[model samples]
Target: MTYTHESKKPTAARREAQKAFREADAKVAMSEYERNQKAFHANRERLRSERLAREAAATAKAAQSESADHVRKKRIVS
Candidate 1:
């Protein structure tokens, strides 16, 4: 018996299916990108706030030390 081969031509239904699959894949990729972007922004904001708080604390400590030194000098002079 001779074996028969199927036609290689693509059908309309197959083309439609491929298009649908591509669209779905694109949507999934876009959503993942957006999620990553949001996480990056949130982390950046958190780090910025922490840095500001640390700087403010450092400034306050320096001011306090300066005031203490000034008072000590006054006591020594008097």
Candidate 2:
């Protein structure tokens, strides 16, 4: 058998290519958004605070387990 100097290059994966395209599109959209908000830094801060407050509220609510009694009963039976 003859020896080869190099291996063939692999084709790009379709899914990976699609993901890269999506990331590039997101960057373009964000730049446009920043341009539009150049005069709205205060609004951005307010919106960020509101989003953080909402997130904290949701997380606190999620931390309160409603099925503690059920879990204890199941453990006892097991």
lDDT values for all models: 0.98, 0.84
| lDDT against true structure, model 1 | 0.98
Off by over 4 Å in 1: 1-9
lDDT of 2 by residue, 1-78 (tens): 998788665567866888899999999999999987885887888899999999999887766554666688899999
Clash pairs, candidate 1, are none
lDDT of 2: 0.84
Model 2 misplaced regions, further than 4 Å: 1-39, 66-78
Candidate 2: the clashing residue pairs are: none
Candidate 1 lDDT, 1-78, residue by residue in tens: 999998897889999999999999999999999999999999999999999999999999999999999999999999
The residue-level lDDT of candidate 1 at 76 comes to 100
